[model samples]
Target: MKKERSFHVYAIITIICWSLAFVLSRLVMQELSSEALGFLRYLIASLVLICLIPLLKLRKVESKDLGLIVLTGATGFFLYMIAFNKGVKEVNAATSSVIVATVPMITALLSRFVYKEKITTKQWIATGVSFLGVMIITIVNKGFTISNGLNWLFLAAILLAAYNLLQKKLVQKYSAIQSTMMSIFAGTIMLAIFLPRTINEVQGISMQIIILVLIMGIFSSAIAYVSWTKAFEVAENVASVSNYMYVTPLLTTVLGLVIAKEFPEVSTIVGGIIILAGLILFNSDQLFSKKVRIKRIGNAELATAAQVIRESFATVANDFDLTLDNCPTNGAFTQAKHLKIDLDKGQQLFGVYLGKKMIGFFELVYHDGYQATLEKVAVVPSERGNQYGEFILDKARKIAAEDRIEQIDIGIIKENRRLKKWYQKNGYEIVCSKQFDHLPFEVLYLQLDLKDEVTNE
Candidate 1:
C-alpha cells in the first residue's frame, strides 16, 4: 500500500509538471518557433540528465536494445515535442492538454493489438466517448473543420503511445533512470538539428522567456520523465500510473488561467468535460465496485453462451486468420447446436456474469473420476481484462474438486503465448504439444493437478 501510494504521488507530480509545461510552452513559444523551442527545451533536459548519470549511477544500455531506445526517444521526445509545441501555439493550453490527454486511451487501444492486452467492454465505450469529445473540439475549433494543429497533436499522441510501449519494454531490462536518461540523450541528439535556429532565438530572448524555458526543460521534460518512469517501475500496472494523466486538462486549464490569463472557450470547456467523462468511464471498474458472479449455466442459457463463445473466439479467429474453411472446429464458428450437443453429452457449461450480463463462458467435460477436460474457456473480447476468464477457471476448479476430479487438462494454440503464460501462472504445466491434421497450428496441452489445488485452498 505504501509503495502504491508513493508511485501515485510520483505520477501526480509528473502530471503537474506536464500540465505546467502546456501553459509555459505557450508563453515561451511567443518568441520561439516550434522547432527552436523543442530543440532548446530538450537540450536543457538532456544536459540535466547527463549531469545526473554519475550521481544516479545509471547503467549503460546494451547495444542490442540501442535501436529500440533510439526509436523511443524519436517518438516520445523529438516528434512529440515538435508536434506538441506546434499545437499549443495554435490552441489554448486547456484544449491542447485535453487532446493530448487521450494518450492513455490511445495507449490502451494500441496495446490491444501490439501487446495483445485485453480491454474491457466499458473501456471500448470509454474510448469512443473520448474520441467523440475530440471530434467536438476539432469541429468547434475550426468552425466545423479539423485544424492542422489538432491533427499534429493527435499524431503526437500516437507517437507518445508508441514511446510508452517502447519504454515499457526497455524498463524491464534497464533501470527507470537509465531508460529515461538514455531516451532523452538520444532525443536531444535528434533535436540538435534545430540548434542553429534555437541558438539564434536564445540570443535575443528576454530574461523572462529564459526563465520560462528553463522551467519547461528542467521540470517538465527532465524531472517529469524521470518521475513518470519511476512511477511506472513501482506501480503494479501501467494504467495505474498513466491514469494520472486524466488530471492534466483540468490542471492545465487552471494553470492557463493563472499564468497565461487564458480562459477556455465554450467549446474547449464542453469538449474537455466530455473527454474527462469518457476517461472516468474508462476507469470505472477501478473507480467503483462491481458485482461479479459465476454459476453453472443450463440448457436454457446455452444459446446465450454459444453467442458469447462465438463472439469471444471471433477475436482470436480474426487475429490468427482462422475460419470455418481452414479450422472448422474453431470456437468462433461454434453454434448453439454444438453447445446443446455438448450439454447432452454431460459436459457442464458455466457462465461468468458481471451484474446480470454474461460476459464469459467455459465448459468442463468429465473424463473419469480422476480427470476432466477444461475446454472452450472464452471471455468476450471487451470483457477480457477484467479477469472473467480467471473467475471461470476458479469456478471450474471448484466444480472439479467437488466432483472428485484429481486433474484438469486443457489445450491452446501454441502461438498464443500470452494465454499460455496466463494458464501457466495459474499452476498449469505443459504436458506436451502436437500438430493435429485438422488444425493449421500446433496445439499445446496443459494440465493442472486439482489434488494440490484443493489442498492449497
Candidate 2:
C-alpha cells in the first residue's frame, strides 16, 4: 500500500509539472513566434538527446523501416508540435490546453475508424458526452465565427490527435527512448528549413531568452516525456492518469493572472470548468472497473502451442496454394526435418483471448543458428484491429531477445502488400525471396538484425 501510494504521489508530481508547461509555453510565446519557438525548442531537445543517448548505444533500424520511422517522427512530434504551438497562439492558454487534453479521445476514435477496433457502446457514450463538453465550452465562449486566427487552434487539435495515435502505434515497434529520439530528430529536420533566418536573427537574442529556450527543450520536452512514459507504464488506466490534465487549464489560468497579470474572462473559467467535469465523467473507469479477458498465447507455454499455430495460420491456409487437411488422431505434432521443422523449439506464440475462448494467435519461431521468425501471424476477424496484433508482436520481440536470437524474420506472401508494408513499418527487412514448399507462391523473407544491443531488436 505504501509503495502504491508513493508511486501515485510521484505521478501526481509529474502531472503538476506537465500542467505548468502550459503556462511556460504561453510566456515563451510572448517573445517568440510559435514556429520559431518550436523550431528552437525541438532543435535544442534533439541535440541534448543525441548527446545523452550514449555513443556506444546506437541501434540501427533496417533501411526498409526508415520511411516508417520518419513518418512516425513527422506525425507524432513535428506535426504535433506545429499544431499545438500554432493553436495556442490563436486561443487562450486554458482553452488550447483543454483541447490538447482531448488527445487520447481523438486517438481512440481514429483507432476505431482507421484500425477497425471494436469500440463499445459505452466508449461511444463517453466520447459523445466528452464532445458535448467541447461544444458547451465553444458555445459559452461565443458563437462559432470563422476567423483565420482561430483556425490554427482547431487544426492544432486535429494534428495533436494524429500525433497521439501515431505515438501509440509506433511505441509498440520501438522503445520509448528510440521512438522519442527518432521523433525529435525528425522534427529537427523540419525545423532546419528555418535555419537561415534563425541563425541571422539569433545574434540579437538576449541570454535570458536563450536560457528559457534551453530549459523548455531540455527539461520540459525531453525529460518530461521520459517521465510521462514511465508513469504510463505503471498506471492502471491511461485515461485516468490523463484526466489529471484537467488541472492544466487551471494552472495556466492561475499563472496568467498572477505572473502575466492578466485577468481571465468569465467564459474562460466557465468553459474550463465544464471541460473538467466532462473529463471526470468520461475517464471515470478507474473509479469502478469491469474486467474482461483478452486471451493471449506465448511460446514458453507449450500446452497451447498447437492451438496457437492453427489459429495464426487459419487465413494463410486459405490464401496459400497448399490445402492443409486434417491430420491423424495424434493431432498437431511437430515433425522435425531440415528446413522443414514442424515448429522450432523455444518459439513463443501470443494471441488475444476473450473469456475462455481464443480469439487470435500470432507466432514467433526461433532457429538454432538463424534469426527468429515471426510466422503464422493472424488475428481473428472480430479481433483484428484492437491493438492485439501489435501487442503480440511486441511480446514476441521481447521474448526473442531473452532467448538470445540474433535476428528476426517474417515471411509473407509477395501479393499481400498491405501485410508486407505493415511488417516494414514495424522494423522488418526483406532480405530474401524465393518459391518453396510447393505453394507456387513467391515468399518474401524479412530480417531484423539483433546485432546491436540485445534489447534493441
Native-referenced Cα lDDT, model 2? 0.63
249-290: candidate 2 lDDT, tens digit per residue: 777677666765756657656655665665565556533433
Model 2 misplaced regions, further than 4 Å: 1-17, 60-83, 107-131, 146-150, 162-176, 189-212, 228-365, 375-382, 411-425, 431-445, 452-457
lDDT of 1 by residue, 289-381 (tens): 345666788888888898899999998899899999999899999998999899888788888787798888888998856899999998888
TM-score of each: 0.64, 0.68
Clashes of each: 1, 8
The candidate scoring highest on lDDT is 1
Q: How high is the CA lDDT of each candidate model?
A: 0.83, 0.63
What range of 10 consecutive residues in model 2 has the weakest lDDT sum? 327-336
